[model samples]
Target: MKIKTTEQYNRIIQGATAILLTEGLAAFSTTKVAKHIQMAQSNIYVYFKNKDDLLVSVFRYHQKKYIQFLVDRIDLSLPPTDALRNLVSTLDEFHRTNKESLDVIWSIRQSTTLRQLIPKVSDDQIFIAIFQWLKDWQHQGTVRQLPLMYLTNLVFSAIIDYFQLIDSKEMSPNELAIEEIVPPLSALLFV
Candidate 1:
């Protein structure tokens, strides 16, 4: 598998996502991903060292894309409170639009083998940026003066919980609207 253009690399990652989503991690392999994208198995090896590397790469690729999406939509010039709101809203939009990718991510996190490869995927660049923003807000007295880890969990847990509720059919569409949830989340996290 000779080196090639970026598109080819993207195609491999896309195929890997599809395989994880449809086949579960137990069935994931370079061979399957290669077959999924109609490429040679060795080609996947050229880009990724092994199965775990490929899985981690796929997760990182999607995570970066998701973070970029939020960054592009969020207005950094706004006050911290408003910017946090924008971040939450952008996250909701990203989750809605990228459900399958999100599903693949969730699946990867749940897999014991893959989870070990990138145990702290949440600590990636996107989260570091958000954590820094939160710390700045705390310093400015805009957000509550809590441990950054607790604050990060508070906001992210709410978002994840809301998605789980919707996915489990525990919350009806109307009940889970961002407008209905963001206010409470804002009150809970912001000063």
Candidate 2:
């Protein structure tokens, strides 16, 4: 029962993603995905050789989609400060809208086996692009001369912490205002 069409493949991937998000990695199985999609369990084998392969595919699909979303929002032509603001806003919005997907990604990263199985998916290309932009800004004396990795971690870690606060309902909307948040973070990274 090899997937004969793009539609079927997408359907299986969607099913897999939903299962991973809801049930988590420990309970994820091709049979569960098949049941979720209302297909025979054996049918999933046509598209993926095993549960690990299917999970890897699901991770890759979401990773590419998320990166594209971030890339679309960021404009390299903008001033470094403005570009950083846009990037932060985009990231906040992405996390707000894709909480479940982000959770799945985080879980995958935490699991050494799954993390190694899909090494390329774990590569944060959007962060790399941002690092390059920051380096350019540093050369122009617009941003502070910190290590690129340190700056990248500082910015993204703050965003991640904000998401966690929101997830736990510990932060109110007023407290999470981007205006109040992004400026200080921008100042920390920029001159």
What TM-score do all the candidates reach, one by one?
Answer: 0.84, 0.89
lDDT of 1 by residue, 47-93 (tens): 88888898999988887777678767877567766776787778789
Candidate 2: residue 12 lDDT (0-100): 94
lDDT of 1: 0.80
Q: Candidate 2 at residue 130, lDDT?
A: 77
**Backbone clash pairs in model 2 (N, Cα, C under 3 Å; residues 3+ apart or in different chains), count:** 0
The Cα error of candidate 1 at residue 13, in Å, is 1.2
lDDT scores in order: 0.80, 0.80
**Which residue pairs collide, candidate 2?**
none
TM-score of predicted structure 1: 0.84
Which candidate has the top score in TM-score?
A: 2
